[model samples]
Target: MEKNIQTKYWVVDGKEPDPGIIRQAGEIIRNGGLVAFPTETVYGLGASALDDNAVEGIFRAKGRPQDNPLIVHVADMDRVWELVSGVPARAAGLMEKFWPGPLTVILRDGGVAAKKVTAGLDTLALRMPDHPVALALIRAAGVPVAAPSANLSGRPSPTTAEHVRNDLSGRLDAILDGGPAGLGVESTVVDLSGETPVLLRPGGITPGQIESVTGRILLDPSLEPGAVIPGKPRSPGMKYRHYAPAAPLVLVEGTPSRVTGIVRQMLEENLLRGKRVGVLCREENAGLYPGAAVVGAGAGGEPGETASKLYAALRRLDQLGVDLILAEGVEPRGVGLAVANRLRRAAGKIINTGQLHE
Candidate 1:
């Protein structure tokens, strides 16, 4: 199959996505062409999940591995069971609570329709995206769309349409210009395939939130390096190094004073080794490492705003050709947990200085 190589970008505002642009995007997907659009979580490069050839195009466009499955975005709950053979009772409970939001439920026997989307896994990751543009495109196209983050595989996920164009301009068929992604991170992935529900990946929704709704204890996988399981993966974010940047990253976690100290030490060490260093922190911490180039999204204590800027900050820092990025970890509460989870994945090493500061 020759690759669908028509590289066209249709910029449309989310406030009022032009009907013509929406129709065009829908047509592209209907005809087996790849369309990149914004979800609340991130911009997803999507293809028709029902079409084997269309799913293959997504793998080629993103340079994603076949084993790393894609999430199927649906317009409504009724459409979900069409993709999955049998939706579990626990999954139904979660759907009632968290659907049309950030939660993605992985279900068993997702049928042949889902097999193409999940890379032949017995399980399928399904989400009802809250973004207007995402829901509009899925409804317009009239098919379950299998989408992954719209960036090179394993690179930082795109949270804006411009980021999508930057990473996939020549590689994609069309880009629907939605505004900035509200969540600025991927969806919270939960596995309901087993007798006990498990939280595969943390995101806008937390395990506590899921437990509150389902009255079940959700387990986080006790993952170790190089540990491979036998059957299909229950969660999407497991078994991969995701949201990485070009430059190496170091996570600085602790109180303000201790984190600052660690950042200074890292900068001094990098300077001694003749390497340029960049820090992803708030403006107040700029003075901590005077010689380093500091990038601040805003003042501290607003994790929602921090989450919005996280991916863009990483992309910008990566583009500057810095040798290393020292990022400050936010308090893990509310949206902060999602922000911290992404930072942990982006950082190559974590420096926990909680005790040192005390």
Candidate 2:
């Protein structure tokens, strides 16, 4: 846990990762060392899933809570069978439809992975990342990799290797740079450890897409807007305040005009109070905020665009050293639901104009 740990940094091609560099990074994981690697969604700090000491190192390096479980990434279905007790019919179907993508499924533990990977829980979360670097590293490591967001816990997830180095340079064994992550959010997590599939957390995958596979899935009550997880979270980003930047953030939700108007008003008020205010909005509204620092998540306020740019925008505002941030929320449907969920958690306060007419 010393601050002087020597970290290796390597750059790999996103399309065709260099096998030599991947092998070196894989060896680190095989030897119970931590490595931060890129996935389609975000960069993940990984360790050998079967190594207890290595898994413990991840929590220590990131200062993450031990109770918060980590997602185990596998290169193939064979590894999936090695980690989970069984894959239900629905879970198997989901894997068929969404594997090699940003979807994490929770299943019963098979007692094969490190105890810490499951956080003493009877269930384990597993994913097959779509990124080439991720799969190459996992395959080379020869073990399921237990990983979480590469950045320090509670911070905006890293979308670029530079972001990872900023937060975890001295704390990790190695960092495999694969350029910027595509989705810029975590995987969609669905829990199938029970009779029905439960949406634990929304992410790159839409609920409608999942529903198309499994008839009707239930949403975790904790995911309800304004609802707090009272106890240990069943998934990452559920229990704690995560994706927060250094400055306090306020989320504004309503019609697009209403959200923009309210954020502008707040921006002026904060500026008048001698505060360095930052506005996080769609590219179309970027010109609306004149004096305040403005960062756009995406153009046209599209959910997919917003989701892919949200974390990076938050990190950029942090670098600007703003005293406060006002973020415009997207609609709670499709990938927009995931975008709004992250914004709500990041915001210290939220303003929802109950007017449903968009």
Candidate 3:
């Protein structure tokens, strides 16, 4: 993989992407090569969805599992149906409202996607990203692009172009540097192959919003702590533990005050043991941990801010060389639920503030 490394790195103005540069990345995808480009959510490792060999390169580049599946990004509804058997009525409504945004829908297989893209299942996940560079590449390639987060399989998902470089610099044919992603998290993945739509993953689009558009949607049981996901997962974030950082992490969940107390106690205890600890908390809670390296999750009480800063905060803590990270969990409501989900998976352990500290 190292021998064929290209010097083709390109940067877009974010306002007006260079058509020529985007076409270059598109050609790579068209010819079965990998390109990492920024999306509104996170940077994505993209390949032509219709090309079996190209899509396989995406799994290999990210060290992603074949059975885990990948989301196909398109430029429009026509491209969407070209890859799926047909979009369900509910899915069509979602696409109408959320296409060109951060939502991925899984529909019945049309057999147009590579077998490996769907993990040989009868369904494939699809989305149309709202990022300029991403859309440009997809349109230039003139084929649906299948992408996973542009990071190593289990590591923190890359939200900036630098993060992608840090993880996949030499592996891809080119990387479109379009500044930091807007969402800083992955898309909401909803499975629509069944009678009632099931939310396979909580993301930028909340369950409440989906319910409003498609009526009541079911939540996969595996989304809860200690519940096993039944059968093969039809969505990307369902199959594995992900968004982990290098240092061991523990999630602290409770009311703001209780969370602060728990984090304060843990930081002190770990500091007494001479462990260099990092606290990922909100701006107001920074003063609680006097001796630990503190990385802010968000400002005010806005979970959108926290969701945007979550991965970057984890990466910053890692850069500070902390031995352990103790994070204050966001409330399990709205986009906050998705933020909490990523934090819990990133953490090897979870501590409810009401529980006694070990």
Q: Report the number of the highest-lDDT candidate.
A: 2
- Measured on C-alpha atoms, candidate 2 has an lDDT of 0.91
Total clashing pairs for each candidate: 0, 0, 0
> How do all models score by TM-score?
0.92, 0.98, 0.96
| True lDDT of residue 346, candidate 1 | 68
By TM-score, who's the top model here? 2
Candidate rank order under TM-score: 2, 3, 1
Per-residue lDDT over 1-358 for candidate 2, one digit per residue giving the tens place of the 0 to 100 score = 6778799999999989999999999999999999999999999999999999999999999899989999999999998888888989999999999999999999999999999998888999999999999999999999999999999889999999999999998999999999999988899999999998999999989999998998899999878767878767778889888899999999888888788889889888888899999999889889999888999988754789988899999999999999999998788888888888898888899998765237
Candidate 3 lDDT tens digits, 146-236? 9999998999999988998888877788889999998888999998999989988899999999999999989887687545566677888
Which ranges in model 3 have alpha carbons more than 4 Å from their true place? 1-4, 354-358
Candidate 2: Cα lDDT at 16: 98
lDDT accuracy of residue 14 in candidate 2? 94
Would you give me the overall lDDT of model 1? Answer: 0.80
Report residue 255 deviation for candidate 2 (angstroms).
1.6
Kindly report which residue pairs in candidate 2 clash with one another: none
**CA lDDT of 85 in candidate 3?**
79
How many steric overlaps does candidate 2 have?
0
lDDT of 1 by residue, 1-358 (tens): 2444668888787866787888888888988889999888899998988898888888888888778888889999888877777876777888988889999988875465635577667788889998788888998888889898999887889988888877787777899878889888788888787788877777888778888866775656423222445555555556666688888889888787788778888899998898988899976777777777678755677777888888988898887888898888777666776777777766688878874224
Q: Is candidate 1 or candidate 3 better by TM-score?
A: 3
The reply for model 1, stretches above 4 Å from the true place, is: 1-4, 222-232, 355-358
Ten-residue segment with the worst summed lDDT in candidate 2?
Answer: 349-358
